[model samples]
Target: MPPTDGTPSDTDVRASTGKKRIPKACNPCRHSKVKCDEQRPSCTRCQTLKKTCIYVEKPKTAEEQKIEDLEQEVLVLRQQLQTQRDTESSIVVSQPQRLMGQRPPEITSPDSNASLNHSSPTWTSDKPLKRKRSHFRMQKEVAVPDFINEGILSEPQALHYFNSFFEGCDRYVPIFDGSDGFAAVRLRSSLLLNAICAVGCGISGDASVDSRILHVRLKRWLTTVILSTHAQSLETVQALLVMACWMPERSLILAIATRMAVELQLDDAFDRLVNLSISRPDTPETHILMKSARTWFLLLNLEQILQVDAGNLVDLRIKGVRRCRTLLNRPFSSRLDARLFSQVELNRLRAKVNETLTSHSDDLLQAVQEARVDIDVWYQDWKRIMEASPLSESELPSLIANLTVQRHWAEAMAACRAVRATGVHQVEMMSPEAHDMLVIAKEALQNHLYVMLSQPHYLANFRYAMDFVWAKCAFSFLLLLKLTILLPDVARQDLLGQGRALLNELTKSSGYGSSKVYLRLLQLTIKKYASRDQTHSGELDAFIPEEFIFEWDFPGLNLFSSPTGWDMLFDQYMIGDDLFVGMDI
Candidate 1:
């Protein structure tokens, strides 16, 4: 009954093991170590362990042991090479420099050459050092172009050629210490001549061929030399900026030059030059250049708004608005001072700019908008003062009020638009102030509207109060809807409604409208109730507020009594109502 499945047992296994014999060698050799297999020059055992494998007698002395060690090292290295060959392809080894018979130069003192004569042992005496004739032979010399060269046919051509003439002289200019004024003056005259030529060509429309050439020459001179050398002087920088402004591609040039002037603390000089140009009566070029400067200034100011730390944003906004006002008020008339105005017609043209301040209110609005502060109250107060002032026009206050409302509406719209523009792509979206405002506004309006629409008992009363409580909401909603249509497909959902359609038709017919607060409210309501359960109250409970179930509207009282009241209602209906509903009452 030994093992039912097999015949062989432990006795047979023991008899087989008793017949095996152990090898009389080192454990490594008996285990068939890879190193022990190396039998040529050295045994694999010694080679694997990196030990000397002397086939003959072992070394008797230290010196002999050292020699044996070196031999073993060589053998091990050769074995390594063989192993590497088995694993990887062989690489071509470069011959050593020593084997090529080339000796590298020795380090010597520089003065050693001067002290050692050709006859000395350290020197090569075989050849007498022929007096080392100057190795500083001039290569091909480039001729400098003369400003008044006879070879050049026209004064413009001569000036154009001379612009590059001083280019080589840049190396000699003491740019760091300060420019050599005399040298700069000569250079300036040459450049100025070229600029004058280009202007002349532009004026005559005949020098068109050389005008571009002159412009390039002048630009190179200003950017490379004049601006670089005399950058300390705002006047010089302004002049360069002015010159660059004359070219078709002026914005980039003006930006660079203005930034340079700003960095150099020559803002006053820059402003002065701009003011002079703007104030110039006779020069159209100067007037246009001033506008370019103003644009640059606006850009700088806009950049500063982003960097604003702790300051009254209201004050900053007022300052910005005032600055724009001042710019608009600056006389553009050519009739008064010919130096201040470009021409008689331009001075006559200046009469039209009395209304420029009104148009520039957009710029003021833009600045205020960027500040992200509430200016509605301030704007209202200012409007009153502006209306009462003899200098202010009758339409100005209404215009300002309209702009202020638009600004607020735009801010809210920007938030909603941002969500569609950004987040829908499965990426993390930055929740900006605008986005938060829209979210709060939308949610509040939506929640309130859903309550109002869902309650059948309040529908009659709601309609009665809708005209007063929801007018503002209706106006804002309409405005928002109009803006939403301008947005891409993804954000159009936020602008949905019958109110929007009604307003659209109205706007088309009457050519005027109010805000879209009400429209957004209606959309929010639809969004809320559309998801509710018609069969059960469970889903509806989540959207409809608990307070909405109770009859809370008080006639002739504040319509915004509901916790989620007319603010939400007006956002949707553009009307204010005096219906008060208290939880306790």
Candidate 2:
């Protein structure tokens, strides 16, 4: 069988193999129990028959078969488990409807297991929610622990507090639209509801209900439930926003709320809707989205105000201010929208002044002057809005009065910063800007004081006596005092008396809890100033005492804690007399 050539014969190769094994047969051959070469394209028998060539898989062994069965069983078991979960979810969802005739089980806390079923239904339902119970609202209905069910938070007292908020404080902040009344708040978030009540307690003069208990419980709930759970929602942001405006932990709360807002993309929602040309739906959900957009606007506005208050340029862009105004003009907006819009616009101008003051450019004075022009234009535009009579006799006259006061306050602040831009050293040698600052400051103080005194009822409201107003009063007082001390001839002495009267009225206002502290510190500073003789003033450095020249803080607020504590006043008097003897004002 061997070939003559070097190539080996098939029989010789087969013989060299000790035991030649036949290949596994293809499907056709295996059915007939015939041998196969295991060729891919065609078996020899199938090719001869001109039939389709097909190969079958090898049979699994006993162990492999057992493993395959186990895998199939696991897959079936997983599917069964999913089915069971779905059934349980359906039962839980239907249980509330099934017991519609009977009272549902009471929810002991916001974390109760039953509340999980309410989220999807509450948000997706298109029907008016007056008839239905929302998750938070339902939980609120049931009496909870002492913390949530006592004092101002109790059901009996909660309405009065909420009413006080809506009537007194809501006009200033304008967070709630007052469409569904308190239901809009209670249904949305228990935390937000509590925050609203706590803020309302500041204005609500209810003696029977102690506000201290409500405040303590709210703080507990904020830290333990909402913050610890890392809850994120539009309601939570609103709650945090409300708290930041009134709470002592303003900066920290604002930071956290703003971070959550970014995570929620609240600032982007309006632009996204506009870009996509998505028609807003006439549903509760759309209303919520619009409110969120407005919330973002208010957040933007307050952030800018705080930055300007701290004497720093706002890091956020001004476009949000514009967008917020547009959003406020949308349907469901309130008459108070104009007030908030005016504030945003005013703060925008203040931000520009702050930017110019912080810059080191040589044309800083010109830039500040230009900024002042814009501020003046703002006053001219909003003045009519501020002066227009309220549409209804029931509308709070203080709303317009407060806006007017804020406008004057904004102008004074702008002028004060402009004076800083002029780099003035002495009040005796005044530049155009310094003279303007003196006039504006005095006029603003007189205007606001007249408003407060002529309508002394304005002092009874929380908005008139809150921290910002108190700060304005304290700042105006200090500025006037310094000016009078520095230039007895140029500045009016009666302006100081007017400033003192304003502080006295503020202290007399029952709603301002910290007015005493504000007035007391100011009085001590004035006392210190009077103890020193300004008549012998060869140099203006000794006009203001060293203690009054630095950062000043109240008990709860860092009111005058800005590094530029005296701003232009610092340049004029805080420096050593040698540094500024020959400098031009």
Candidate 3:
């Protein structure tokens, strides 16, 4: 069927666009703004985009309207033809109908095509297939070596090793034994071994060794010595305590050991001498030894208490006064004066004891009452000593410096003042060793004041101590500096002055080695201050020797890691929000 006119038919034009135009009843391509060639079913644009080719009803142009009507008629004819073909195919396939009961053929209308498009893909496979077998290689077993022999040592060998390693050492001599003591030793040794073993346990890196066992051993040792009551065991306990006190990084251990010593009433032995007649006229040597022993005990007591409860400043001061009174009661031979009557010595002792009431406990009301009773007594004693064969003014500075080393700050200050009152600056100057003693005393007083100031109850006493020490150290340093610079023959007369000059010269000439030893005392004092206040950051820059700070390999410092030392210092120093903001360091 060619067209009557010479023009090509609409079907031929539709094939070029790969689309078909439809009637007004169903023309989705026209509404979708795609080119619709006049065909019955599918459109080119939907096919190209792989979208569902849907036919929806729409109005069409006159020419398109004619083509659409023809398409509907053609569709009806195709449906009839498909029905006839299906009937014929069924008849041919079922020629011997008796083999099975004849069944009617299922009818599918032209509209069924739309229903088929909506259905999902079938799940059944067309053919059945067998799976292939996979082969796996077997792994060989590994044999592990037995470690039982290495794991545990025999008891006798262990004991021999332990004794050989620990018995001769002053710090770890064994003093206890029971059924369990051997086991305790083994346990402690095992802990040490474990710590060593842990270092090698990790495959790729060193592991942290647990120090808890070591801490526990120290704690138990402290407890045993402190709580032991046997008189026979006191010597061993005392030895252990002394050793424990000397252990590095063991402040807590020392504190506990000291407490144990106090619990065992060892301090009472020293206190007992105050009541004894060791100062009898016939036994001057015994008196001296007793005095020395008492002094030693007092200092030890003070040191132990200071180590434990440094924050309890008022209690320490009170305890110090009580100890002083106890010492005063026992008159040393040195104080008797060979020419003085025994009664005079007794009277002087009474007066000295009375004078102690003035400095009683740093309490305001108590101090006032005690001062009125004691000031005259002290004044008389001072007058007697001053008038009768007084020490040379030149000797006072050296005496004071020695007293400072003995932890007698008040006596040292008095000696310094006495030397100063004589208008003899050159003799009053401190040598380098004397300077070191002065620094120690100054640091102790400052530490005492710092602790006192921290407590609200001791504020007034704190101020007094602070003012006294600050003025004393400042005046002494200034005097030393002035004398070192101004006095002729200073280097020959004063070792400390010469040391200072040497240090100055070294700094100027870049001689670091000689300066470092001299600067160590100052550096230690600075370290104490830093630890006290937790402020060691830039404060050490000026005090620590440049060579020591830069050249020495500080223990526990990791050079590869980012700087954590400074950060830790900042955390330790800053107390509260007051110093939190704008902290550049």
Candidate 4:
């Protein structure tokens, strides 16, 4: 059996061991009893003979099977744990609908017929089993009635509204920054999509459903679903801010949105980003950081303006409000950024003026001079940006610049009103304050006339939902009406005629409810004056109600402020006062 050279021969060794050859051979090679070389796909013999080669695997051992089953079970447990974690993160809890005196929205599950626990011991039992459900449901349950399904806005009509929003509404709001386009927005948040459509419907005036009704429906859905769940989402904040700017219940909705943003830590991010020294790279995280930061800045700007418009003084001592200057000083910021900063500065100056006037300070003239100087300084600081080329996406620069100038004119009127308020009631026709007020009022009215004649769309369409726009126009008309009656000798007849013509046009063309009320007052006031002049020729003692003429608390009288002093006026004019209270449809 041993070889001659002290090694065994292959044939002698195999014969002595009595073993088969090539145990690892492929099926074809093994069947032929040939060496296989154990190649992955084929053996040398099979390749040479042109035959199909296949390998037969041995059965797995018991321990290996058990290990695989355990791994699959771990994977399933991990998925269930992740689901539980996600459910815990949301704000919704059990039976929240019952707390609101409403039933929970019903949703049908696709896996209704499948057993949730097939491994349970009672899987085949006929006895009833207790159903298990999540402690909270974060998914959207209240569905927005499809405007398209309701035949309010068709697909093409919705496209038109979307286009209108991107073209115009986005310029003012700028909330949808770095959006991936309409389809992506639609896929992400239907609440935001519907809010855009409703605001656009107000601007475009093309919807079959009344724009107010659309807004009401959207508000209902937002409160029922988004607010009820306390959804901590950036899209929810954006939708609320947009509605606050364009719809009723502005103050309350704005407060809620600001609170939500604070809760979401946007203010912290805003301060941090404003203080950062190095530039951030182009990443998704950077995009989100920039978006949240910019939204916070936008919210602050809106708050300042809203407070000033409501005749409330804003405390600029807040750190976040002060950061506006730091961001303004940042180089290479966008034109919109420049505009936003300038608005904040301008509104800040306006609040200062309101505070100075409301306090009845002794040095009123000096305070007015200081406020005017501050406003002019702000204008000079942003003058270059204001005159720069229009944005690539919009022509908002020119529009905003014009609006700033109009606001400046309104500010001047406010200053004049303050000066006149200090003078005597009798012999008021001869007072220098009266003359000064008339001069500024005439200029403001002429500017509005110019805008109406040249850029009708600005007033008629893009700004239809902005209450301040109508408020300013109404205030100017009221000033002209009251001043002409007081100073007939100094009244400019041509300006009065032009103001009446504009009011008539607005009454006919505008769809806002406030516009109709102010224009009707104009007609009624003219009739009152005419009838009084005919009956009492030179007796001007009881000509017009002293309160009506002198009271700054009346609606449409204060150009830049809402009426917060009179309950009757608020009740009669502020129709949407309760819109956001209980979120009633």
Write down the RMSD of candidate 3 (Cα, Å).
35.0
Which has the greatest TM-score? 2
Tens-place lDDT digits, model 3, residues 116-187: 100112122223346565697433422211111244334454443334323222111112222114344333
lDDT: the better of candidates 1 and 2: 2
Candidate 3 ranges beyond 4 A from true positions: 1-254, 276-296, 299-301, 304-401, 404-585
Ranking by TM-score: 2, 4, 3, 1
Task: Give each prediction's root-mean-square deviation over alpha carbons.
Answer: 28.2, 13.0, 35.0, 21.1
- lDDT of candidate 4 at residue 514, scale 0 to 100: 45
TM-score of each: 0.24, 0.61, 0.25, 0.59
Candidate 4 lDDT tens digits, 88-167: 43422232232112233332223232222211212122346677887986655554454665566777876777777776
lDDT of candidate 4 vs native? 0.54
Model 3 lDDT, residue 10, Cα = 57
Location of the lowest summed lDDT over 10 successive residues in candidate 2: 553-562
Kindly list the per-residue Cα lDDT of model 2 for residues 1-585, writing each as its tens digit: 333332334643463343554335555665555787768778888788665665433456799999999999767755664554456445512222211111223222222122212222221223334665556631223222332444435675777777877766665566566563776567646777788787677667677767666767767766543433234567778878887777666666777778777755577655643432246534444455556666776787778877777532336655645454454434545666666777877877777666666674465445645765776677666655545524312443755566667766666666566665565545556665567666665566556556766666666563424455555566656655554544345444455455556556665664534544456545554444545543443323423433223322211111121122232333423354433233221
**Local distance difference test, each candidate:** 0.34, 0.56, 0.32, 0.54
295, model 4: CA deviation in Å?
2.9
Candidate 2 clash pair list: none
| Highest lDDT scorer | 2
